[model samples]
Target: MVKSADGVIVSGVKDVDDFFEHERTFLLEYHNRVKDASAKSDRMTRSHKSAADDYNRIGSSLYALGTQDSTDICKFFLKVSELFDKTRKIEARVSADEDLKLSDLLKYYLRESQAAKVRLGCEELMMGILVCILKQCRAVWLGSQRLVDWGRRNEDLLYRRSRSLVDYENANKALDKARAKNKDVLQAETSQQLCCQKFEKISESAKQELIDFKTRRVAAFRKNLVELAELELKHAKTGFLCVAPAILELTQ
Candidate 1:
């Protein structure tokens, strides 16, 4: 039995026990991948935050430098240009780190796709087992119905004894037996119906879980993309600052 988010217990069918085990294994692997991705995301977030803070600090320092006299401004500009060059190299390293991260993210996405395929295969196997079981149950029910019909039709022959009292007794006994058999068949059919209902509910829950997993993966991807874009913008701004003094000198 597996417990769902709602605390409902989903009983696994014996026929699909192997499939369920395979699914459990896959889930374990998927969980590990999620943990790795989460760790990487956290590192990336911290790195980006540190880089942003450093850029802000440098910008504040540059603003203060701008308040000095012309000679001091020239000396500051020279130093600022050297600092900007160093910053440009740092930006390159950051870009490289982002590229590596993107690569890892893509690999993780591929793994997710493979995992989804495995999950789909498992579902298909479970569905096949369900269909086979339903078919077998239906066959049994149909066969039981035919037996009941045959017994009813042969009631007279079954009681074809010489004495009237004996014949009446035999007919009553046969009727009782037929009624018991019908009751058994009805109970079996009811059990099968219940089992089918449970199976369907479990299948739906699995589908919903898959959807939720994909939603989370997509959200993470979007977040990473946004961060990468922001990093690129920051790099471009730094480049502009590095070239601004040269532009101003040429203009003069």
Candidate 2:
């Protein structure tokens, strides 16, 4: 039985077990992909910042040379240095925006996905003895025990009934005991039917829960990706606008 968040026990069905297995696989693949993405995003942010610093250093060197020389060429160098300074500012902004929108987003989701894996009760994901232990594993164990108990009781009842039948055939004096054994078998049958019904009900509920989980994660990923794209476009446009006038000035 799987323990729900509310502490209620739910039966484990084939579909629910399959769902957990599928989800576990998905999370593993997704975690690896996102880890790589987050690392790349970090590298990109650093590259942007490094480029900005280089631009600033070059602009400063040019400005110093222009000031020391004081010629027409120096004036031209001064103008170019000013353009470099402007470019440096734009690059800096780009770096900040990329870190905020892309790097941070990737990192947040990386952590979130890890948390999700834990919450899903993955067998391979354990923290301590009591912390984030595998709920699915527990469910499977309980389900197995339940099945074993039912089978044992069924076999015992059948064996008892068979023996009672043999005794009834062998002697007329064992009729009352045979009737008692038959009654016990009938009670066991009733219990087996109730157990089956309860199992079916829990299985249906668990299946729906698994379906909803899949849908919810998909929607969340879609929303985050859309937002990231929009922010990236905005940053690109702003960077372009910042550099256009500098390009025109240099051309003139």
Query: lDDT values of the candidates?
Result: 0.48, 0.58
| Candidate 1 lDDT, 1-252, residue by residue in tens | 121211111122122435435655665676667667657765774675577557556755664575465676656665664564456465655645574445445545544444443333322111110011121246544643443343332222211111222223344455566567765555555555555555555555554555555566677579767877787777777777766765676456
Which pairs of residues collide in model 1? Answer: none
Judge candidate 2 at residue 155 and give its lDDT: 29
Which sections of candidate 1 miss by over 4 Å?
Answer: 1-20, 72-75, 78-185, 197-252
Give per-residue CA lDDT, model 2, range 148-167, as digits (tens). Answer: 34333332332232233333
Q: With candidate 1 superimposed using the best TM-score fit, by how many Å does residue 157's alpha carbon deviate from the native?
A: 53
TM-score of candidate 1 on Cα atoms, chains taken together: 0.40
Q: What are the runs in model 2 whose C-alpha is more than 4 Å off?
A: 1-16, 119-224
State residue 139's C-alpha deviation in candidate 2, in Å. Answer: 39
Please, what's the RMSD in Å of model 1?
20.6
Best by TM-score: 2
Clash totals, every prediction: 0, 0
Which ten contiguous residues of candidate 2 have the minimum total lDDT?
Answer: 5-14
TM-score of 2: 0.55
